[model samples]
Target: MKQILQSLSSGITEIVEIPCPSVKSGHLLICTRSSLVSAGTERMLVEFAQANLLDKARQQPERVRLVLDKMRTDGVIPTLEAVQSKLDQPLPMGYANAGVVLDVGAGVEEFSVGDRIISNGSHAEVVCVPKNLCAKIPDPVTDEAAAFTVLGAIALQGIRLAQPTLGETFVVTGLGLIGLITVQLLQAQGCRVLGIDFDPKKLDLARKFGAQTVDLSRDEDPISAAASLSQGRGIDGVLITAATKSNEPVHQAAQMCRKRGRIVLVGVVGLELSRADFYEKELSFQVSCSYGPGRYDPAYEAEGQDYPLGFVRWTAQRNFEAVLDMLATGRLDVAPLISHRFPLEQAPAAYQLLNSSEPYLGIILEYPDPQQPNDLLNPTIQLEQEHTQTKAFPSESHTKAPIPHQPVLGFIGAGNYATRILIPAFKQTNATLKAVATTGGISGVYAGRKFGFGLATTDPDSLLNDPEINTLVIATRHDSHADYVCKALNAGKYVFVEKPLAIAPDQLDAIQSTYTSILNSGTSPLLMVGFNRRFAPQIQKIKALLANLKEAKAMIMTVNAGAIPPNHWTQDAAIGGGRIIGEACHFIDLLRFLADSPIVSVQTTSLGGVELREDKVSFTLSFADGSLGTVHYLANGHKSFPKERLEIFCAGRILQLDNFRKLKGYGFSGFNSMNLWRQDKGNTACAAAFINAIESGQAAPIPFEEFVEVTRVSFEIAEAARH
Candidate 1:
């Protein structure tokens, strides 16, 4: 499959070949027939990508602040690596597309194979999209017209906000594709419409769509022109659809509206308002989000859930259906809006044509043979010829095989986590680095070059297929951990995977089934999870100190683990296993280490639903030794506040560890002594132990049974909380 991507560093566009993505449950596999290149939206993306480092910094001061804050918390080296990795990633483009279904995933009852669908699937040849993000296309709608579904949804949403009544006067600012579409929809609602834009060509198109068009470039005073057209009463409402960095468009909308008029913004614009204009007219100002009600709601978008039509009349998907409804009848026309078309193979040229102001509107990328189209976009793609030349390390055959005395190491998923934490730590170890594989092109290439790996590939299976690579380190997303681990184990290679062995219980069972066969073999592969907190010097010292206490009856542990936003893909139950399964596992594992006993029961409570507030979760773990541990996972805390604070009560003594940096012990006399700990030493120790265990052919780093038990407890707590 081939996909289009834009390089942020260079602003260059390229179409690269990559492995076709497999369909997942509740997902639709679509072979794209046509995709619309939203000129206003895509042009802004291109310009932002092309900006220099200083210019980019000036444009996004908040992002600059975040980078500086991360440096303070995570230190300099890790922050720098994160920034580099982000820069190296190529961002995918396009959202509105018309395609035919190649196959449907499990539990997708909406469409069947060979059905035409309109979706926000990008400009890819093949796209595996969640079912909710797609809608069925009627037989009457052409591929080009069907591709406008998402854009029409945007326009429909804006119109829905204005709620223009019959005979009401409406003005649409910025006559782009969305602006023109809004003008037509408002006209269909029996509202008198006026359109404003600097582009004479787009103004002409708006006029054809039943709007009274005013060319801002030619008219010195658009406010007067609009008023004169409205017979001096002023328009009832105004929709600003222009994309600009200046707040002038918003100011125009305010000036051109009557008293108590509504001003809805459907495009990206600066919202620095002039208080007098709004105060005098008492106008209502609103920014209509992408599409409508359910656009950014994860449950509605990814989980195939829907809001009742009676209560929520117009959702993002419903907005899409409304657009198709308009097209099905003669109420709305979009065919006249399209100005240019290019085949999928000419995608690079299409971007160039769109970038250059060569008199075009609604440029569409067409696929002649709908059976086979490019599908991979964004995070996945093939390396360009130039990228292929930048060797991360010598090819497999070029590098000599590892000697018997040396431990050969192969890695999968060289993402920021691997580069910043694992690779740097491994550099300090005695293990011989052989290869690193990553789906993203630049990270694998850059890390392989910097760390002197023997090979770099976009495919993890290639690493598994290599004969000389004896060990595998998996740092990919949580959903992929089980399958990758099973493959490595079957290949007779030792395995080390990151936490939360798998996202679901069934996945864990599959991994455990493979474990038995490996154990039956004489040399069972060592399976280790990256639970580095167990190796922290302070934690080790605490365990030793607690071991000597004779009268200790119970222990309480408080973890101030911070919150993650609900929109983050990690919060999605399918992908990241939610916060409890994804992150709470670390705290649970740490508790297991401290208690030195298996957790018998777990209970959880939270203040709000999973989507609203993610920070306020409390968990209690019961150990067989009659000990109890409490974890306070609060999302609302100052960044400057210490992240992790642990307190222990045992044998009439209280011990506290503050942020893993300082520790204090209080004795019976009320005397206290404090100690500061060194950073990086714990991480270094953990990495060294992992490498040594692989080299010596010893037992797993942590007991495999204990690791599985901790995972089970973590999932159980989350499942209980969700119910």
Candidate 2:
């Protein structure tokens, strides 16, 4: 399917054909009819993307600090590579969409095939949207008008927060798409409206929508204008919906609002508040989130968990229904709001206009008959001219397919981890780099060219279905690991996936059942999880020393993991599996490796109650060998401190590994300390081991049963912690 994406590094927008996402449970696959180009939000993104590197850094100081911290832990070279890889990724554009439902995923009951719907899906030919984010379009609304549903909801949410009543006067700053919509909605509530903006065209549209206009470009004093519009009394309330760096909109609204009046902001602007403006008047200020109550709650939006209508009267989807009702009843008019329309192919021209000084109110992108054939939507789309994998190093020139004895590797995800570590490690081995794939074409091509891949594509199944590729390396987000592993095994190829193996027991069960079937058929390929800590040089040395001991070992592992922002994908338990399954699995697997036995039992605890935070946690493991292990994984810690520390005691001897850089041994004669100049967490050795095993037709370095056991332990710990 064709999708539009914007390059944050270069500020370039392009349409690229990529794999269509499969409709997941509780989702609807919609073939887009029209989608709105948000003037205010998209303009902010485009301008931010067009800024210089230093300017971008200044815009996000927190990310800059993260980069500095990475440099101190990881080397400067790797940190630079990760930063470049991040910037090279293209971000998907647009949100408000109107489309016809092509198919409904399992567990969805709201809509079926051929139902027209309005959703917060991006600008694409096809979108797989969660049911909660989609609302059915009434027959009276046209596709172009329905495309404005999400924007109307944005405006309505702010109005809801302001809580205006009949005869109240509300000042709406910035007569852009959202501001104009706000004016009409306020008027519908029987409140007097005053609209403010610098553009005369928008001011005219506001007047058409029943709002008194305040043109700021004509040196109009908004404070006096607002007071006069309120009939010598200050405005009852104010809604600032302007996108600008200047805080004048906020300042003016605070100044013009009547004493003890409410102010709600639904736009992005500088918030340099003055004490007098708010304190003297006793004003109540609130910044409204996009759409409304259930916007970012994964449970509500993604998992189909709806709040009761009586308890929460206006959820995001409820706001959509309200806007549609108004449109159906002839109360809200959107025909006069749309300024321009472009087909999906010419959508680049629409984005170009966003950067220009043109007057655009509600620009819409319409989709016509899809040019792609039906077969292209299949799991695999093959391309001719596959790269020959056996080309020798340039110094030893030979162009031919690699010998069957060697492993031909095709990477499934060219993300930050793969770009910084896994790809670089594979460069040293004799394995063949056949292909690479990512969700976006730019990253796939960029990392492919940089890492010397035979081909690059935006489709995962294209790599999986290729006959020349014999081994698959999975490094995408956490949730998809098990599915990729199963596909590779079924395709008769070896698999190496980063941990944790599976986020849920059901996914693990599927993998186990598949592996068992393969085993019975004598077509099973090796499967390994990248629990690289067990492969560390110091760790192996510790294992060898422990083998000579006569007593069981007690271990303590402390991880100062530090914090990631709450909104990061890794924090989404449904996607990245949260911290326990995503990262703490390493410690769990490492302990199992040292004990050389299965984990017998698990227990866990956390610092927060019912808050569901994975940041601060402690868990204990009981190993079959009678050894006990405790891991204290704390995310709220000093970044400068060593990330990991482990201590082991057995047979009157103590051994400690500190951040994989130093191993200290005590209470043992003739045993000396070991150190490395740089930290080595065993990722390189782990990749090499997996490749060498495949080349030699040997058993996987980490046994498949151990992989399953470690994953179960991680799950148990997380479940116990949450309870």
Q: How many residue pairs clash in each candidate?
A: 5, 0
Residue 96 of model 2 has an lDDT of 96
lDDT of 1 by residue, 154-198 (tens): 988888898899999999988888988999999999988988888
lDDT (Cα, tens digit) per residue for candidate 2, span 1-723: 678888888889888665566677899888898999999888888888898899999999999998898777655665676787678667889999999888888999878888999999999888878899999999999998899999999999999999999999999998888898899999999999999999998899899889888888898888888888888878989998998889888889988889899999999889999988999999999999989899998789878999998999999999999999988887999888889999899999999899898778789898886564343343322222323343322312224544675888888887768877788788678787767777644455545656667566667887787677778899899999999999999998889898879999999999999999999997756999989988888898888888888677899999999888776777777888888999999999999888887788887879885354576899889888889899999988888677899999888889998888789999877787988767778888999998888778799998889989989888888877666
Distance from true position, residue 579, model 2, in Å? Answer: 4.1
The 0-to-1 C-alpha lDDT of every candidate, in the order given, reads 0.78, 0.84
Q: What is the TM-score of each candidate against the true structure?
A: 0.80, 0.85
> Pairs clashing in candidate 2?
none
Give the poorly placed runs of model 2, Cα more than 4 Å off: 371-379, 382-405, 408-469, 474-492, 502-525, 537-555, 563-582, 594-629, 647-658, 661-679, 712-723
| Residue 463 Cα positional deviation in candidate 2, in Å, after optimal superposition | 7.2
Query: Once model 2 is optimally superposed onto the true structure by TM-score, how far is the C-alpha of residue 228 displaced, in angstroms?
Result: 1.1
Give candidate 2's total backbone clashes: 0
